[model samples]
Target: MQAFEAFMDDLERVIRSAGDSGRGVLVGGDFNTRSPTWDPAVSNRRGELLERWAASCGVSLHNDGCTATCVRAQGSSVVDLTWSTPSLTPTVQQWRVLTERETLSDHLYITYEIRGPRRVKSGDGGGHARWNWRKFNAECFRESLDTCLAWGPTGEDQTTLAGLAAWVERTMTQACDAAAPRARTKSSNQEPRRLTRDRRAASGPHHDIEAEYRASKRRLRDSIKAAKAKAWEDLVGSVESNPWGIPYKLVLGRLRTASRGLTENLDSETLGRLLTALFPRGEGSVPVSQEDRSWNEG
Candidate 1:
């Protein structure tokens, strides 16, 4: 039992490391545990531990249909399990216990398909190469753009309207690429910053150190405020400049996602009913009745 616990710990560490490195991980084997989380009939210490471990490691069970994966002459149980990283979980398709396959062992075959990441065409200018607006270096972009333009378009590039337009676009893209690298992953900037020293000690450890810590905290707060203000300004400028660009798409997507709670599973008739309930159509404001006026006066 101690050895098994150590093994589970190691497995969790490995899985977490792989996930942090942005690798798709698929682990399938006989875990030899019984938990109601995976199997409907049994819950054991091992199974509970495994469930907790998988949750901490950000792995999800892909055991569909809850079919038993182990069979013996005495009885049958679900010992085999399939686990995948969060990013790979959705790609695990057709997860099922292959009861018919002859494995010549107690554990039945668990099979699933892992769909690979979709490959975007190079010239599509997909999100893979989208400009990183948050980290854009304006001065660098200006310098790079000036250098590119200084080369001057070749005679052939300026011969036609299409050629000139393409040349201009290509130069701008080159400058953008140099100044702002693509962000492959989204990250939050709102997470609280960690103090240089633990706050407990900084609160009353030493007078000078406390003063320094207070100054540091103030600086951090000011920087956070400035960053937020700049980001808001940039968002407003982007929407004003290009109403149909990334900022607009991002906001629209957020609004659509938020609206899902209000709109999900609602047919047109249901939507109309809800709209009418909230806002009854009238030609104009109707005069208040005597009873309503008495209630208001009371």
Candidate 2:
């Protein structure tokens, strides 16, 4: 019992750490224990403790109360339980207890939808996502950068590394904002197209943003279905045309999902390089860095 108590303490710490990134968490296993929330066959001390632990942490119990997670010759018990954080609880579309299984253990198979982070489109009410890298104007960006970098950090501002970093970030952000401002995603204020256009739009999508972003996987479902059908068609066409060249592999490929239109995931070294790229000093200006020469290039 002492060992079990220690395990529960460690479990809480782990769950807290997992939720530190502001994302939902899922912690589950055959907890050789029983609680009133999940268990039905019997009651025990360990199960009660687990219930309290879950309640204190604000986690949601996923057991349907009557669904038994285990079966034995003498009797069955709901030992295998699942616990989810509030953020992830609603995303659980379904929970099931599989009865038929070829296993020695009494514990039945438990299934639930543990959703991942739902990344939205560029202009869905919030993210500054209209960054068209394909159509980026290099010359315009260069001129904007130069204009911003001309007013470099003064001698007083260059006293500390932190100050220099702040100055560089401000300069780069200003330049980017001025030169290539991100396009806004409009909802419905545009001029109406013909009925044909409306029909085409209906075949694809209409809503820019969803109310419940977590469980709203309608977009993902439709997209995968469409891709699968297109891939099938491409394979058929390729077979009909050549039968040797697989056009499905070459032509029927989708572009990678883009970033959130910002340089976010950067280490200390990479961050230094990015700053240097934004502000490479001229002859009269203070040197950015000797190691970041590649970034300092035109």
Candidate 3:
């Protein structure tokens, strides 16, 4: 309709003004248009026109595939869309619909964050350990723990509850450290986490035959490596084509994340103390009797 076109034109003007001022632009709402680009359903004339308008305005579509943004008694479709200027696209992380949020409308709630440079926390330079669950030896862990427990009540630790708890905690920590593998520093050249997880799953003991699992694992690894190499090549090509563009901005983001380092891990003693402080013991509190439950009867 003429009215819809006029409204779209006004939105384009606002987006252009923001981009021209060197500020980020994020426009998101019910577009009332359907396209296969953002959903599995068929396309419409309005969606095509909107796509053209976005291209001309230098805005990128941030909606991920096949998620139903609008649901009704009839069915579901992805009518709602999120658009961001090219400068803001790389910074937009986790652009997805919050289906659990009750909006009391047909359209689902969408959320995203424009991430900034991460600030490095103190004591995070020396990386902390995290259990590599994929390589954990459960049998080994059990044996180690049993051995430690068998040698119980050693020294004055048995005299006090705190000392006994500390001793037990130390024993468990020792067993876990011995039996579990630690995750290493992640490289910038590492493949995507999703792909890595898929590869791990393929290599797991789910296949009927060992050879089938091995073949699947090989294929997944090869595919992931090829995809990573191709993506890097494309990024390089883009940088070469446009010296100051989205590719450059994305590279800057990667550099910032690489320098931020991993988060520090809290020890069990500190975690326990924090939990205890947050949920203190109610020594003198009285328990409510069942006879006082008059609200349930009503």
- Report each candidate's C-alpha RMSD, comma-separated, in the order given: 30.9, 33.8, 40.2
Query: Model 1, 148-172: lDDT tens per residue?
Result: 4543454445577886786787667
Off by over 4 Å in 2: 116-298
Per-prediction TM-score: 0.41, 0.42, 0.40
Give the candidates in order of TM-score, highest first.
Answer: 2, 1, 3
Best by TM-score: 2
* lDDT of each residue in 1-298, candidate 3, tens digit only: 7787888899988876664454667888888887778877888888888877876676667788788899999999998888776445545778888988999998889888886423223344344435667888888677556544443434445677987786776556556565665455453225577788887888756644788878999999999999999998988888778977778777576434434443236677887888788777786545667886767555
lDDT for model 1 comes to 0.71
Compose the digit string of candidate 2's lDDT tens values, residues 1-298.
Answer: 9999999999888776655544456778888887666766678999888878876666766789887777889888887778776545545647888877656777778877754334336457565434445656777557545533433454434577886786676455544443454554563234344666876676543333433453468778888999999988877877778844665444664333466424556677888888988888678577567785556356
lDDT of each: 0.71, 0.65, 0.71
Clashing pairs in 2: none
